[model samples]
Target: MANSLSDRSSGGHQAPKNKKYQMKREALEQVIDKHISNIEKHSKKLPGTFDKEDIHDLRVNYKKVRAFLRLLQLEKDAGDLHISDKLKSLYHHCGTVRDWQLFLEELHDVGIVDQLPDCMHRWHRQVFTYKEQTVHAIETTHFKKLLHGIIKELPRQLQEDTVKQFMHQKIAAIHILLLAAENEKDLHSIRKQIKDIIYCIRIFKSDWGIPFPFRGWKSEKELNEMASSLGDFNDQCLAISLLQPSYICKCDYKEQHILRNLQINWLHQKEARQRQLLYEVQELHVEHAF
Candidate 1:
């Protein structure tokens, strides 16, 4: 699976503190710092590769650095220094790419290429071309340079308050986004928004504590698992989005029936899980003494 997403911690255990934790944090930060340095060196000679790797590293380290800074802010623990938003946007870029990559992988998996009618096959190919064009646009611009500059300046920007503030803001944004989505009857959109919201929650959990508010919820582990399941459902929705309209049109009655069956099954599962999560999120708000 030639995935660019690399697990910096190979042991698959919670990152421990002490000498071992300190060593890993320092080493990972150095890896990030060196990646920035490499981007600067190659920016003039090469272009896309630096941007690509820089974005990947930024996403990889987002939770790590966020956790490190949160500990420093909330607990007086020692951790790596923070980076700038310009550097942070680099992570955002990789995120956009990753979402699309997931989309493409979905289309491929659902046998989209083979499912389309012969007459519409050419149009389906064009849809793939559209996806590729969006990707290339990001790779060709000064977007990469901007991300690199942020990376270069990151170590100096490490601050406890900054990371904590950002986390709070993200939580607020998720709440607001969900409220807006609840008005629409599109389960697809609701599921997508929930996925993003819960993903933000997971990022916070993986960095800080599972229950997110730390003081709330007995089933932090269960909440995390629910988010993971919802995310899988969102992935399927994204896959559906990527597939060409023509491909869908070409499906015979039986093929369409099968597709609908697959979709309905997923939606049923997604709704059940999301209801449980909704209750949990509300409970957290109450726990915060809201």
Candidate 2:
């Protein structure tokens, strides 16, 4: 991946002469627009496949497509990124069911289902209801029809000059936000913003073989280490938030107690990973400042 990124970066010098670069950019935008269109047109078919595994796969696809579209919009502004943000919120909410489902599956896999609360078993039964609601919301014809109206107007909005201007504005805004994130709440927000940037880089890296912007901006190994740390912290945070005491209150059996201990261990490991990453991120920023 790094080698390909290097080759592509070098190849761009010769690309100014080729219409292929322009065409590819256009094609990329069109493909993204088409996918958005598909979601808008067929969202009503969403709820039938709301199972845990299926929802997890859908979440992955949604993240990739949403990330790709946002990156493309940064460079091309053909679609409304706010729409993508809304979709991400919905996706995150929908993830609660999948997370719980995984938690239960792992418990069963380890042969500890009997250790959990009777209430947890009951909650697991209703997981499908939450899943179905999320799917239904995403698939609603009304929502898609509203999005279709805005998205279909893309080609005109995505002029190269406009996209360039849009990117400049966005980069500047994110930079300011990064600089202003001082408190824990601010840092939390910055982490989300940076994660989105990383997501975009990963998507572009896979799709176009481009060097990630962060690569040019900092030490590759250090940045990666920090990113890994941030990811661990975020995952822990998500797990903690999703596992309500209501879930735990029901998990009070001795073996069920063991499962809770495992969760605590997981949280500790995640925190340790995050602290290491956070220190590294700060160190790099200080070094860069000089």
> Which one wins on TM-score?
2
True lDDT of residue 138, candidate 1:
38
lDDT per residue, candidate 2, 20-97, as tens digits?
Answer: 222244445444554455544334334665555555555655655655555555544354544544565556656776
The TM-score measured for candidate 1 stands at 0.44
lDDT of candidate 1 over 46-152, digit per residue (tens): 23333445544445445444444443333234433455555455445555555655654554565654554552454446545643553454345454554444344
Model 2 CA lDDT for position 253: 68
The TM-score measured for candidate 2 stands at 0.61
User: Deviation in angstroms for 213 in model 2?
Assistant: 8.2
Give the residue spans of candidate 1 off by over 4 A: 1-124, 127-135, 138-144, 151-157, 167-227, 242-247, 250-277, 283-290
Tell me each candidate's TM-score.
0.44, 0.61
**Pairs with backbone N, CA or C atoms under 3 Å apart (clashes), candidate 2:** 43-139, 44-139
Off by over 4 Å in 2: 1-14, 17-29, 37-57, 64-81, 84-90, 105-112, 117-119, 138-147, 153-188, 202-215, 219-228, 250-267, 283-290
Worst window of 10 by summed lDDT in candidate 2: 14-23
Model 1 poorest 10 in a row by lDDT: 1-10
lDDT of each: 0.44, 0.51
